[model samples]
Target: MTQSDFAAPSRYFVDESGTTGDLSRAGAGLDFKQQPVFALAAVGVDDEQGLADRLAQIRTRRFPQAAELKSSKGHATTTVVSELLDAIDALGGGILLEVMDKRFTLAATMINTLVMRPVSPDDHKPSALWFRMQLAEQLHDTAPVEVYDAFIQACRNPGEASLKAAFRAVLQLVPPETPRDSPAGAIRLFTLDSLKDYRKAGVSKPEVQRRFLPLPDLGHTGKEVWILPHLSAFTNLYARINKLRDGRLAEVHIVHDDQPYVAEILRSSKQAVEDLAADNKVMALARVDYRFVETGELTFTASTSSPGVQAADLIAGFAMRHTRDALAGSRPSLESLKVFHRLANTLDGAPGFGMNLMLSNRDVLRCGLLPSQVPPMQPS
Candidate 1:
């Protein structure tokens, strides 16, 4: 069937909260500290109007007064989220729920060591290294092998594991055929405070600076500095979300209590959506905020808006766009064209090739241009 003949994919709404230990200091506040639980939940809605109605019910249940609603309080917030999941499940939609018992400190540590820090040159070693150190400090008598095996297993299959193991156990609650592999229509929920704590504890500014800075003789005098911890936190979150999206979980809607933290994530999400859409030749139809029915809290939804393009279509368009652009405005010999074609075919595994081609100079040069062009067409 043609793309138009297919139904729009189902949508998943996701939100996260309660992962950090010191709630008092976190953006979500002291109440979250008491729970020290971090949760990521997803709920599927049939359509935009249905989503709005459900959110209204959640809002009425959680907050009678819109003015008094705050994003960080766990008690009412938890109830709203729990109720929303129940409603979605009752309606035969999918639900994913995961909760972590570790102190926010420990969870933060794990996120840092596992997800955030590995991309850094200094922390590029196996994830087991830091995990072992943390386990030794916490359990004392536990063997590293046990911890390593558990961690790897959890990462590979979050649906089977508890939030305590991988923080992704919520997926288990979802229906097995929930269409997680769809291009569009997956909703994701996230909490920013937990991510912030993890970033602050796991990464150091000096480390990033050291890696990015060039030696004096290299002629790069200024050091690349990132002062705001939120920058890296959101950046990491964006990467993680895209990873999920690439894996076929679309329609990600995040719920975060901390306004500032949520705001940053929104900003990053907006940029990501725009960049991805533009690079892929897809359009972002809409991003709007609505109240949660249970809590009377406001949440945001980002949608493709139009009926024409599926999420995968957008991705494909981006690839085609880049390929076209790469092939345009250049005169390459037959051999050079062959090399470009081979390189493009090999790198097809790369996500958002069109976007990557446009945004990344390296990919454009490598995939679009001939290798012989390097070093003034020096022979291989």
Candidate 2:
């Protein structure tokens, strides 16, 4: 198969963060630097909703009570791997999973290099920006090689445009000297500022901060890749649905998971999502569901007797809870997106403040939120 072979459908980008356990708490007493495993993955889909719904059906045992599906585990640290896998399977897509190796200290080092470090005097830039670009390139490069090769091989011929876009997205990151007008350049510029702003706002360090740069924008972009091929199909379906007078052409569907930190990641990543949405000019839609996988009230032995049932029940209950919460009220609607300058004084102390600030603002614009809308808050 070659890039010249197949016709592209509406495409989509799909991704997954975390897995089935509470790895965020893996560092209970250890140095903040030491943490267990967490994973983030991105996949391209031809039919996002259909894929999501199909996966939900397969995992129906996992979410019995969700009024509507949502794809987050409403906590500060955990990844819902099962739900993520279901999503991948349902969408008929391939994945690029980023797993933190237990033996590698790279995760922590990378975080410090990107997030904890205030500014980079050496480059007169924020380390975060550099780190984000590097990370995005790495993931983009490795993932397609490891997983998408099969997809590529399976295709009799793939669309040249998509293949070129995907290849360009990855290639732009490597060689380090690639021109700045590429996707790699965009990622680097976007991430640096995002981290800087996050710190300025005094947002508490996320569990993964010490081990990962937390480039939510990259994750969102990955999802876009999964969705792009299927855009035309979705648009047509949406148009027909509108003719029926059901409601908005856009539909928000969620994939439910039972990981606690998934929700927090989703929340924290909200800024990144908004950034990607704007950069890509697409309506962003996502939600995360988190709940306890264990029944503290029941004895371990009793719970073990019906592990499947217990897990399913817990997930369902949590989904309903979240649905109710979303119905209760709305968050501020995203009216517009823009980038602005941060007072140099506001950025003074941060080591890589300048670079970080610039990238963050860019990401905000990319995600479809106005940088000016983010109020300044001091770092914790």
Residue lDDT tens for model 1, 160-260: 22223432232222234545343111211121232344345443444432221111111123322112222222233333334323433344443332333
User: How much is the lDDT of residue 341 in candidate 2?
Assistant: 19
Query: Which candidate's TM-score is highest?
Result: 1
lDDT of each: 0.31, 0.29
- By summed lDDT, the worst window of 10 consecutive residues in model 1 runs over 371-380
* Model 1 score (lDDT): 0.31
Best by lDDT: 1
| TM-scores for all predictions | 0.31, 0.26
